[model samples]
Structures are given as structure tokens and as C-alpha cells.
Target: MVATEVGDKRVDYIPGNSSIRLVDFPLKDASFRSRRLLQLALATIPWAEKSQYLLFPSIYELEPQAIDVLRQELSIPIYTIGPTIPYLSHNQVVSTNHDYINWLDNQPLGSVLYVSQGSFLSVSSEQIDEIANGLRESGVRFLWVMRGESSNWKNICGDKGFVLPWCDQLKVLMHSAIGGFWSHCGWNSTREGLFCGVPFLTFPIMMDQPLNSKYIVEDWKVGWRVEKEVKETVLIRRDEIARLVRRFMDLDDYEVKEMRKRARELQQVCQSSIASGGSSENNMEEFLGHILHGAKP
Candidate 1:
């Protein structure tokens, strides 16, 4: 199923133009309850085909092969104007001093790990406990963004880390004190991590997350997987998590140094794509030109 082609291989979609793995496809396994939502999401494909234009919130440089292939296969005009994150907000000054920012500022450069599992579809309490305990044991300085009951976070994280309900995710990732990211591999988080040039510790949950993790760990070689296999039944213990976190945070590690290097390279690519006359900029201009000039369908 992983190697099975879904359509013509005339265009290079996946790396080497290989067939998308069954596991890599979004919503690979849909339960009866989720089937309706899955159908609704899938319905967009045909709808896009009938439209005059299609806009992707992604950078052409990031997925050149996929974007190029889609333009070749599809009849309508397609534009990649992305990294559409709240980058503009970064310049604005906050009225109040955030404790998290102060904490990050005090930490040594690239000495902290930033952890967030995403706002939706969180892991089980058991998994959460394991992760929290593991970070405590790892002896690494970390900033974990978690929602809900925070009463026991101090005990769980010990003195090595800070836990909060939320923070400016992109801002946190871009901080000089942040060394690495422990992420759920959501596309938005993944993009932010790449943009900030931070290596990842992928703990993907579902849907596009697993595929994003694959790209981070395998294709990009900028990160490592926290879970060898993503299964609810498989609980990664505290000791293992501690060990992985330790190795990941070790900046002196030769492998880690290389991974960080690759991450920076990708970050440069992301930056260039958004700069003047960049791929993303050009695409945005073209898209607006079409609209302003009232180009025919």
C-alpha cells in the first residue's frame, strides 16, 4: 500500500515521485464516527478541480515538486502563498511583560527545548504523565505549553522546566534561547519550527501529523522521532523519553550538530522564499494581479 501509486507518476509529487505511502496519507484510518468528516474533507478535491483558481497556504520552495506537479496535472491556476502565519504580529510590542518571555530571555542561548502537543486532539493522560515525568528526568531545561489543570505541573516538571497554558508559539520558537522543539508535527507547528531553524522531537498524533513527522525526521533529516511507531497501545515510558530528550538537547553531539545545520539550511530556504522577489512573494503578486485585473476563469 505504501508503494502503490494513486495516480499517474508522470509528475514528481512525493520525493523521487514515489507513490504516497498508505500511512502518509491524511486520515489513513477513519472510524465510523469520523467517516463523515473525512468525506467532507475529501470532497474538496473535486471542488478544487472545478474552480478557476486554487490557493495553497504553503511555500513553493518547500514543496516545489508537489506544487509543480499539481500545476501540470490541474487545469486551473494554483498559487502557494504561505508560511501565512502571524509573522506581522511579531513586531508589535506587548503591554505587559510575560513571565515566559522573561524566562526564555534568562536561559542560555539554545539551551531550552520548547514543547507543545497542539491545541486539539491531545494525547491520553497516561501519555501526558509519561512525557512530563520524562522531561523532569532528562535534566534538560524546557518550556512546555500545555492546556487545562496546571496544579501539578510544578511537581511533574520539577525545576528543570516551565509549564503554561499558552504562549506566542511562533515567538517562542524564534527565541534565541530555544534549542529544540518537541512537537505534535502539525503542519503549522512544523512550519514554524522550520522557519525558526529549530530541530524537532516529533510526537505526531494523527492525520497529516504523521506525514509531517516523516518529513522532519526522514526527508529533511532535521529531527528525530520520539515514538518509533505511533500507536495508542504503545506507551513510551519516562526513562526512554528522558534518554531521547537528553541526546536531543546535547548540542555537542556530532549527529545533533549536523541536524541543526540542516535545520538552519531549511530556515534559510524559508526566509528566502518570503523575501523580496522570492518564490512565495512572486506567487502572491501573481495571485493578486489575477484578482485586480479580473482575469477570466
Candidate 2:
């Protein structure tokens, strides 16, 4: 199917959306098991149609074309009430002072790189080792959120950065010290990164990640890909990783400056969407009104 759609390097089109390409489809190169899972998940689409309303946890401005297409195709009223990642909670003060928050407090503005792969899947041990050594070699300040084996990573990373099992990811992204995000391109992570206005170093692992990476690098133009190719067997060496990290963190570079500008622009858009009289706010109010009245549109 991929071959038929992407024949001879020609541009491939998605089924309904013309602005997005088939090559950027989430299931383009999915494994057999992943494909089966996707097939099973698709069964919910018809089920959704049976309902009176369909609500998407996504910002309408970010995907206007796709949202419009869905509204046209679906019979029920569709609402986009998104940026639903608990970003507003950043305003709530917590009583406890965590070590990571204190660590971020001391760092220079736009100097630290925040690294996190998704919780569902991760890169190989060898790749992790390379990333650890590379970050140390780059001489850049980083705060990495890892799940396991913190002691070993600390030994590899030395004193240049902090590696913890977990942190308040949205809070970390909102920190003034955070310069860029090294991510696995999970949908939630992607949304948070965009909301925070942070440039990205995309290292997608599987599932919808590659497509998210494409949007970050190609469509959004706010990030660069850490791995140039999609081949799992090919390892990105430590030296190359160091070079990329160093360049990505360099604030003086003209290209990096432009990317940062774009990132800030996107952040403004996200903030506006959730504000009063904004697109998301209006949609949410409409949805609430419908529910309260128990009336069909």
C-alpha cells in the first residue's frame, strides 16, 4: 500500500485532507502488531458517530482544515475543546519544593535542554548510552526525565545536568530556563512543547511519533530531527549527537533564533485559543450549552 501511494517519489495524498501528505500518516510504516492495534482502534469511529456530539481534545486553530473536514463528514455536532493537558494548573502553587524545581530556578534563561522520551516506548540501551555521553560531551545544561536506572545514567552524565525518574513535565516546559525540548513526539508531549513555545529536537520511537516529528520539523518549522533516517538498526553515534545538541542549544545562531521566534508565535496561538472569546473557549461554551439544554443542533 505504501509503495502504491508513494510511487517514484511523487507526493502522496491522505484520503480526505489535501494539505497533509500520506507519507506523514501515523500508520505509514507501522509494524504488523501496531497495524492490528490501529485496525482495532478504528472500530471506535463508527461508535463515535452514534453519539449526539463528538468532542476532540485538540485546538481547532492548529488543525482547522482537518477539523472542518470532520465536521462536514460527521452527522453529529463536533466540538474542538483542546489544549486539555492541564497547562492551566501551572498557576496553582504547590507547598513542597522539589529538587528539580530548585535546580531549574538556578539555571540561566534559555540555557537548559529538557529531555524526555515517552513513557510507552523508549530507544535501545545503546542509544541511551550514546545520548548520555553525547550530552556530557556537548557541555550543555540538560534536565532529563527518565524512568529507570538513574544511578547508572548519573554516572554517565556527571555533574553537567540532572536525571530524575519523573518531574511535572508541563511545569518544566514552562520554566524560563528551558531552552529546547528533546522529545519522543508523543501527542501529549508534542502539545505541551508547542504550548510552551519551546523548539524541539525530535527523536521519535514508534506509532504516531514519526508523523508528529514531521509536523514539528516540516510543517511547524520549529524543530530539527535528531535522527535523520527512520531505520531502527542504524545508531546515531555520540559525536554526532553532541554536535547536534551543541548546535541546537546555541542561541547565537541565526537559524536557531528564527526557530525560537516561530516557537513563540505558536505558543501565543495556543494561549489565545484557550482564553476568553477564543476559538476553543467559544466551542467549549457551545458544547456546555447543548449539554445543559439537552437539545440537538
TM-scores of all predicted structures: 0.89, 0.90
Give the candidate number with the greatest TM-score.
Answer: 2
How would you encode candidate 2's per-residue C-alpha lDDT over 157-215 as one tens digit per residue?
97878999988888889888899999999989999999999999999875678778878
**Tens-digit per-residue lDDT, 189-297, candidate 1:** 9999998899999988767787788778877889999986534355899999999999999989999999999999998888888889988889888889888999874
Model 2: CA > 4 A from native: 1-11, 15-24, 28-33, 88-96
In terms of lDDT, model 1 sits at 0.82
Q: Which structure among the candidates has the greatest lDDT?
A: 2
RMSD of 2: 2.8
Clashing residue pairs for model 1: none
lDDT against the true structure, per candidate, is: 0.82, 0.84
